[model samples]
Target: MKKGWKLAFLGLLAINVVVVLVLLIGLLSPIKEEPLPKASPEKEAVEFHVQSNKEDLNRVIKAFIEKEKAKSFVDYNVYLRDQVELYGDIAVFSERIDYKLTFEPEALKNGNVVLRQKGIKVGKINLPVSYVLKTARDAYHFPDWVKIMPSDELIYISLDKMKLESDLRVRADRIDLKKDDIRFTFQLPIEQ
Candidate 1:
């Protein structure tokens, strides 16, 4: 019985030694962890549709003109009726002559508005369209986005070049005077 007890004690001691060795090895081993993901610098853009009517557009355009007038004095006033009309006075031989210029507005696919010269009434006098356009281009203080081409007898409004607050961009999706349907797209940037 003593010999059997000694053998049992030896067996228990060996098992205990193996368990301690395993625990020590586990404690000394290096632990590995996954690194955190980095943030991306790319930005995304969101698009929004805006709809307006002729009356509201007229008011907004008038307000914009008024704001622009503060920067520089402009004698002309633009309004949208059946057609885009420009009412202003021009200097002819040192005399101020009132003129009404009408233009047919055409919306381009690239977010631009072109005004084709439709008619001009200069105080009961007949003047060439190109001549009148050249005079207006030279006299009026137009915004940078407005380009007047005398030879082409047209005025181009670059809506894509317009700068708005908060890095927003606008595009003319549709502009129909007869149907009174005007639509625009506003592009906004989203940061990740």
Candidate 2:
């Protein structure tokens, strides 16, 4: 209302406009997105195999499972699969393992098997989280052993000079509606 007050208010408004205009210009300026480094085709295909196993490791896994079962009735039907030598000094092995309840008869038939793979780097193998299970009848659960359960597996015998162990896994190609049927690159040792 007063001349002095009006001038002061107008000056404040001018300052606000300048500030808002500067901010608008800054916001409208081009913003660059960081570019992601491109991966080479070969490097992109980098993969590792399961740990190679010799007679020693083979006997150990089998005997260990057997021993555990006899001592405590913790039944684990393990079938090794996907034995590979993806890289030098690296060995990966995988298997389909079913761990039943201490005394559940359906123990073997109540759980699911995932086709797990690993990328072996030095003495350790990095297991990936991709295993296949028979389709779930309804929920995200599988009936462990419906139709033919995966039994029997493969073992990659490593060279005598290499000190390695065998890991086993079941590889799946697709997931079923019930998550029951699974397709794999290889066949089960059971072959049925």
Candidate 1, 53: how far from true, in Å?
0.9
TM-score of 2: 0.21
Q: What are the clashing pairs of model 1?
A: none
The lDDT, on a scale of 0 to 1, for candidate 2 is 0.30
Mind giving the per-residue lDDT tens digits that candidate 2 earns over 1-192? 699999999999999999899866643544333222222121122223333333333455566546544643223333322231212111112533332111111111112222222322223332211111111111122122222121211111111212223322222233232323323222122222
What range of 10 consecutive residues in model 1 has the weakest lDDT sum?
33-42
Local lDDT at 108 for model 2: 13
Highest lDDT among the candidates is held by which one? 1
Index of the highest-TM-score prediction: 1
Count clashes in each candidate, considering only residues at least 3 apart in sequence or on different chains: 0, 26
CA lDDT of each prediction against the hidden true structure = 0.77, 0.30
